[model samples]
Target: MFNLFKKKANEIACPMDGEVIAITEVNDPVFASKAMGDGFAVEPSNGKVFSPIVGKVTSVFPTKHAIGLLSDSGAEILVHIGINTVDLAGAGFDILVTEGDAVDLTTPLAVVDLEYLKEQEKPVTTMVIWTNSEGKEINVQLGKSNAQTVIGKLK
Candidate 1:
């Protein structure tokens, strides 16, 4: 029998160096409750944020606190930086890409001032949520990871 209709899983790389944690474990209620879809979060060890998938930039929030992407395999992802960091009004974030920019796993998304975020008393737990994975399942490996690590897969 010729096998057909088998969908390959799309890999999601880690966007930064950190310990990856389950989406439920994140400190934010909206993301913790899966209200924004399923994904993972990272307690970053540094300040650089990279693209976690091969995608096109769908949105770059005005406050520079989050970025939206449409993956090549059709997963809609939202990468949100910190808890309430948006209130800073783009003070500690440097946007590296604009909307519509094509990006791969290695592409730098933004540069955050970790020290500034700390000084502002913000929780630097970056969340990566799959905003539109209605029927798809995402499985993430929770542990230490770097930008090149394939932390999750969408199937």
Candidate 2:
């Protein structure tokens, strides 16, 4: 008998609620061009971003503007809070997990002060990039997504 369809990978949940769009739609060239990796951008509806997979927090910038994670499945996800808000010098970003902390799909990595960023004229759109996504099957869905949404699978 033929075996039933099976899924061998875990889904990468949407790290935040937003309008999910391709990286090309991002205003930044590095992300928009997908030169780094194949991932997407989120025109964030809120400031809080959750862990997209179960993994160790590889790095949390001193500026607290971005978070890097490595999943058990070897997915490297970088969550950048805003566009050029790094100039805010971490003023509007609050990172919850530190380096080497184990996090799951629902774990909140950071909470941003969207209002503060707006006051400083910063774009609150975030990027979820798979740093090493080259040559892999890009399995993400583009559109509206949330923490509970299985946006894609990373390998």
Candidate maximizing lDDT: 1
Residues 19-61 of candidate 2 have per-residue lDDT tens digits of 9888889988877898877888888888888987777899999
TM-score for each prediction?
A: 0.92, 0.90
TM-score, prediction 1: 0.92
Clashing residue pairs found in predicted model 1: none
Task: Give all candidate RMSDs, comma-separated.
Answer: 5.0, 4.5
For candidate 2, report its TM-score: 0.90
Residues 34-110, model 1: lDDT tens digits: 99999999999999999888878999999999999998899999999999998999999999999999988778999
Off by over 4 Å in 1: 1-9
lDDT of 2 at 89: 86
Judging by TM-score against the true structure, name the best candidate.
1
